[model samples]
Target: MASRRIDVRAVSKDPTGQVLRALYAYASPDAGAPCTIEHDGRSIAAREGEPIALSLLGAGVDTLSRSVKFHRPRGPMCLRGNCEGCLVRVDGEPNRMACAAPARDGREVRSQNSFPSAQLDVLRVTDWFFPKQFDHHHLMVRYGTTINEVMQSFARKMAGLGTLPERPAEAPLPEEIDCDALVVGLGPVGLSVALALAGEGLSVCAVEEEPFAGGLVRDSLQWHSRDGERLCGAEASDRDLAKLRAAGVSVRLSASACATFDDGTIVIQSDRALWVRAKARVFTNGCHESVGAFGDNDLPGVYTARAAARALRYGVRVGESVLVCGDEDPALDALSDALSAVGAKVHRLTEGERLLEATGSSSVSGALVGRDERSAHKIKCDAIVASTSRTPAFELAGQAGVEAAQDLDRQCFASWADELGRTQRSDVFVAGSVAHGGRSPVRESAVARSVRDYVTKGRVR
Candidate 1:
C-alpha cells in the first residue's frame, strides 16, 4: 500500500524577504531512509527522526484518545508530552505518549481506552447519561448489597486507562553515575549554566527530555537578534551546543529526570534507568502552557499556542482556517503570522474578547467568541488556537527541598531564589522560568553567574 503524504509547502522566503525554514534547516540534502508504520492497520510513511504524533496529525488523524470518565475526545494539546491527551498504544505498550515516541517501521499503533474506535467510541454515551457527575464511590449507597456489587463490577470495567500487556514486563537494570554538577533541563538557561560550569573545570551532565536541546526555541518562528543581526533559533542552538561539547559537557537528549532525592541523587530514565549523584544540581525545566477554561475547549481541534507552533514546525497542517484567541504574546503573534504566510485564513479575536464555546461533533468545526454575554458572535474555522498563562514546572524543585510560592503577578508557582539562581536549598539551584516567571536574556545571564559562583566558591554571590 502506498503511503499518504500531507500537503506541506516547501521552505521559502518569508514576508520579510528572508529565507525561513522549519525546525532545523539542513545545509545539504541527505535523505537518509524512509520507513512505514501501521496506524490502526493502515500503513503511514514517516521520516527517519520525525515524531510519531506529527506523522499521524499530518495524515489528518486527530482525536487520538478519549477521556477516562466522560469519554470526551482528546487530541494533542501540548506537543511537549506534558498532557495526557496524546496517549496511545504502541507495540503492545499501553498509554505510551504519542508526542514523545519516534516513528519506527512496522510498529503497531492503536488508540487506547476507547471502545470500537477513538473517533466513534460507544463509551461517549456515558457522558450524555451522566450529564453532571458520576460518583461511582457512592453511586448506589442506598441500594442493597447485590445492587452495589453489580455497580462495582460495572464501574471497575469502565474505570482505568489502557489495556494491560499480555506478557509480563521486564525491568531494565539501573546504572549509577557520579558527576560534579547535573543540570536537569537543557533549555537556553540550563545550557548556559552547564557550559559555564564545565568551562570552570567541573564534570557537568546535562539532561534534556526532548529529542533535541533547543527547548521551545525549536518551535519558534522568529530569530534572535545579536549585534543588530537576526539569527535563527535553530542556528543559535546549534552554535551553543557546539560550545558545550567543546567544554566537555556530557549532553544527554531524550532523558527524563523521573525523581530527585534529598541526598542530591537524581533518577533519570531513557531507554534504561540511570542514577546520578552530583555535588550541585540546577533545574531549568521551564514551564507548561495552561489551557483556558471554556465550553468544549477540550475538543480535538483546539490547541494551545505552543502546540500549534510545534505542529507547524513538524510540517503538520493545523487547519486551512484558524481562529486565534487570548492576550498578546510574541509566540501567539508569530504563530498567527506564520499561518497567514502559509495561506491559512487567520482570524484573531479582539483583546478582552473571550472564547465562549467551541461547536463540533468529532472535531472542531467552528467556535463562538464574545467580549461579554451581549456581544456573542460565531466564527467558522476548523482549528482554534487559544493561549493562556504558563505554569512553572516546579515538581523537581519541590522534591529537592526548594520552597515554591505562588506569584500572583506571574500567575504561576515560582521557586524562592535570589537573583543568582540560588534556591532555599544551598545544593539545589533554579534558573529560567522556574526561578522567576518568564524568559529574559538578562535574567538568564544573572542565573548563570550565580550558578558558576556557587559551583566554584561553594556559595552563590
Candidate 2:
C-alpha cells in the first residue's frame, strides 16, 4: 500500500469553524499553556488544559498507537481514558492514556508493545505459530497442574510494555453527604438535569471526573438550541457549576462514583472514600469512546479522538501533525479545526472505505491510509487519533442486573422503566444518559420529571 499525502485539491474550510474558534479561545494562553507532540516530520501543538490525545487528533494524527496481540492497527475506543487501547508513553513512562493526560510541551512520547514498527511488527509471527493456542477453548481444556507453569512462562515472555506502576494508596476519613437528588456526570445533559432539579429546590449532588466541570460540553464542537442561540457547554458548564453551588447543591470534581447499592445508597471514591445515602439517584455517567480491533492497537500515540479534544480544552499541544480518521461527522470535523488552531496540520479520512494501519517505531511515526477504498496510502504523522463510536457507561447498571434493551434508533442499548424511572427493583431508579440510549440531550426534562415525580408521588410509576 502506497501512502497518500494530503491533496491540495481536497483542502476545504472547516465546517465547524465558529465552534472551533470558541474552543480555542476558551483554551487560550490566558487559560493555560499549549501541549505539543512530534510525529513524522512535524510537531503538533495545542493550548494547555486540553487533553493530550485531543490535541494530537486535532492536529490530524488519527493513529496514536498500534495494537499488541496481532500487531493489528488500533485507535481510541473510549473517551474517558479507561480503555487501555489509547495508552502512550509520556516522559518515558509507559501506558499513559492520552485522553486523561493533560498536554504539556516538551513531554516525550514513545509507542509501546512492538518492535521495528507498529504496523510491520515481527512478533505477529507468533500468531502464525500458535494461533489455536491463544483461543479461550484451548486454554480451558488444560488442567492447571500441567498448563499453569507453561502458561506462566509464556505470559512472562509475551507481556509487553506499559505495566501499571505501583504507587502508594491514600485513605481519607469517611463523611456523610446529603442530597435530595444525586446526578453523576457534568455534561450538558447532566448539567441540565441538575439545573432543573436545583430550580425545584431539591438538593443536588453532582460529580465530575475532570478537574473542572462541563462533561462533554467542554469539547462540544457546537450545539444550537431550538431558539438558534449557540451554546458552548464550557461557559454553560461554569455557570451550571456556579448555579449548583448557589442552589446549595454539593458539586464534587475529580470524584468517581464507584458503586450504587440497594435502598438509594451510593459509594463514591475520590482522593477519599465516602458514602451518600440519597433519596434518589440520577445516573448520567454518559458513555465511553469505542476502541477499534486491529493489530498492535495498544501502542503509544494511538488514542481516541475525545482524548485529543480534551487536550485542546486544556490548551495543550498533542503533536505537530496528526491524522484524524473516523466516520465523517460534526464531532470529528470539530477536532480537525481544534488541532489546527493549536498548530497541527490536520488530515481527515472522509471516504468510508479508507481503512489503514498506523505505523511507527518506539512510537507512531505515520499511517498507511487507504486511498479511494482500494489500495493503501501513507500519511506521515506522529500520532493517530482514531475512533469508531461511543458506548454507554452502563457498568454499574449492568452489574445491578438492570434489564437492558437495544434502542436501534439511538444506536445504543437502553433499559425499560416507568415514567418515574423505577426499575424491576423497587428501590432502584435510573435517569439521564444511562436510562435513555446515550443521547447528548438525553431528554433532561425527562430525568427531572422522573425524579420529581418519585419524590412527590412516593411510589414507583
Candidate 3:
C-alpha cells in the first residue's frame, strides 16, 4: 500500500491491457480534493471521497484493534463494512466502522477498545491468560452471585466499544411512500430487475447501500450484453442508471432496506425513514463475501477476493506480492489477473489445496497452504486474498417471508424462491444472486413480470 497508485495503466498496451484500462477508469473512485486526517493524533494524507480504512491501510496503519475478549490482533477483512475488523473511533464517535466512513479533511480517527494503542495494547495479556478460552459468565459463578456480577462488570468494561457519541444523533424524518415495486440492492441483478419492471411501465424504486449502483461490478470483472456490443459491468451500470432515471425509477443510492413488518411494510433506512408499501417487493439484496475458516485468518492483511479487488479498483494495492487461494471461478480468475496486470505478483493455490493458516504477527505476511496440515507450506506474501462462494444476504428477505435453506457446500443459508422467483409470501419476491444457491436467478424478466402483475392486478389501482 502506498500514497499513490502504482501507475500500471501506462505499461499495459495489449488488448487485455486496453480492457484493464477501461475497467480501472470505471472502477476508480473520484480523486476528490486532497485532504489530511489525524489518526491517533498523527496526520495522514488522503483524498476526500476515499474510505478512511483504505487511507489508513495505504498509510501502512493496519492493526485496527485487538480482539474484544482474546485481544488477538484484528484488521480489515472484508473491507465492505460487513466485518468488525475495521471498527475505530471517528471524530469522537465510538465503534464507527472505518470502511463505511469517508476520510474527510480534519477527521479524527482513533483505535477503539484497545487499551493504550492498537499496535501495542497491554490488554492483549488477556489472551495469554486464557490458553483455552475465557468464560466471564462462569469465571466466579461457583464463588458467589456478587463475585459473578463483579466479574461480569469487569468483562463489560473490557469489551470496549469505547463510549457514547460526542453529540446525540438527530432522529430521521419519517415518510410514508407507496410504489408499484420496491427493489432492494442495486447490483447487477437488482439493476436488471428494476430495469425490467420499469420497462414494463411499473413504477420502480430501488435502494442500494453503497453510494454507487453496480455492487461488485466496478471492482470485479462482470459484463453485460447491450446493443450487440459487450459492455463491462461498470459501463452497464452507467447505462442502466441513465435508463432507470429516464423511466422515472427512483434509484435511492446510500439507502438500506433493513426490515419488513408483518403488515407487508418494508422499512428502508436512509437519510429518512421510508415505510414503503409496494404492491410487490423484489429482493435483490445481492450477497456478501466470506473469509472462510483458517488459523489466524483474521489478520490485518487477509482479505476476501472481492474485497481485495475492490481496494485495487479504488486504486489501492493491499500488497505488492499477493497470494490468492480458492477454488477457481471466472470472477476469481479475473480478479487475480487484474491484480497481476496492476503489478502485484500473484500465486494461485491450486485445486484440492487448502489454507491451513495465515501467518503474521499483527498483519498478514504469508499464508500456509496445502492439501493437509502435514504438507502445509508457508507462501510469502504481504496479502492473502481468499476467494470463496459468496453468501446470500438473506436477512431482509427473511423479514419478507423468504425461506432460507442451509447450503452445505457454501456452508451458509441461502434464499430459496420458486421457479418464478416467488417467495412464500405473495407480495414479496426474490431474484438474482440472492436465489438459486447464490447463483444467477432464473431470468430477471420473469421476476419483474411477477411484480408487475402484482402491481396491476392487486389493490394498488
Give each prediction's root-mean-square deviation over alpha carbons: 2.8, 6.7, 2.8
Q: What tens digits encode model 3's per-residue C-alpha lDDT throughout 6-117?
A: 4544546334653465445654444567799999888998878788888888787878877887888888888777888888999888887788888999999998888788
How big is the positional error of residue 341 in model 2, measured in Å on the Cα after superposition? 3.6
Tell me the spans in candidate 1 whose CA falls farther than 4 Å from its real position. Answer: 1-13, 17-19, 23-32, 226-229, 437-449
Give candidate 3 regions above 4 Å deviation: 1-5, 8-15, 18-24, 27-30, 141-153, 222-225, 264-271, 406-412, 437-440, 459-461
Q: How many collisions between residues are there in candidate 1?
A: 0
* Top candidate, metric TM-score: 1
Look at candidate 2 and tell me the lDDT of residue 306. Answer: 72
Q: For model 1, how does the per-residue alpha-carbon lDDT over 158-226 read when each residue is reduced to its tens digit?
A: 789988975666778877778878898888778888887776677888888887777767567678664
Question: Candidate 2: lDDT of 136?
Answer: 34
Better of 2 and 3 by lDDT: 3
Instruction: Give the Cα error of residue 452 in candidate 2, in Å.
Output: 2.3
Which ranges of candidate 2 are over 4 A from the true structure?
1-26, 30-79, 85-168, 223-231, 264-269, 291-296, 350-352, 369-374, 418-422, 437-442
Q: How high a TM-score does candidate 2 get?
A: 0.70
> Could you tell me how far off, in angstroms, the CA of residue 448 lies in candidate 3 after the best superposition?
1.4
Which lDDT tens digits does candidate 2 get at residues 387-445? 77566776766655677768676677765455555666543456656665444334566
Query: Could you tell me how far off, in angstroms, the CA of residue 347 lies in candidate 1 after the best superposition?
Result: 1.2
